[model samples]
Target: MSDRPDDTPAPRDADELNEAVSDLGETDTDRLEAVRGRNESLEERLPGDEQLPRTHGSPEKG
Candidate 1:
């Protein structure tokens, strides 16, 4: 007389876990693109969007 429903989604099996790990292995490009985009936007907001002023004689023997 058990009335428990069994429509719940099945837990991820070994194959699914392996595939998930494989997918994570190939997501570097997307991550890099997002970081580059954020960096450009932040540079635009700063006072000097081009480059910081170079220090004079800070590092000799160049």
Candidate 2:
């Protein structure tokens, strides 16, 4: 048996997936909120909280 429990929710079928989509609401604000949340999560996963400066047209690194 797997160590983790199967308590996680799953889309049993297409109908369930459709229902979830409707429940989630396909709005622009919702999409922006989701993207912001994802960006926050990715930033948190970065090496440090420092924001590096942009170095466009710079020399290639070795």
Candidate 3:
């Protein structure tokens, strides 16, 4: 079975399914935050809206 329902086939074995689930657990937070940051940045870039802080990038130098 697959966590996702895209065109791709679902995992056909217990080991493959376990591997996929473990991979999700490992990267869930980082991936979610990245999505959130992109969303915020996009909103901030809209015309007539206040700019939001960027989610990524090196800190500015003094």
lDDT of each: 0.68, 0.68, 0.68
Task: Report the lDDT of model 3 for residue 8.
Answer: 73
Residue 52, model 1, lDDT: 61
Worst 10 residues of 2 by lDDT: 47-56
> Cα miss at 12, model 1 (Å)?
27
Q: Name the lDDT of candidate 3.
A: 0.68
Off-target runs (Cα >4 Å) in candidate 2 are: 1-25, 49-62
After superposing candidate 1 on the true structure, give the runs of residues whose Cα lies further than 4 Å from its correct spot: 1-26, 49-62
When summed lDDT is taken over every stretch of 10 residues in candidate 3, the lowest stretch is 17-26
Weakest 10 consecutive residues of candidate 1 by summed lDDT: 49-58
lDDT of 2 by residue, 1-62 (tens): 86667996653798875565564448857866876888899988886524655456686678
List TM-score per model, in order. Answer: 0.36, 0.38, 0.36
Local accuracy of candidate 1 as per-residue lDDT tens digits, 16-36: 976755643457676567668
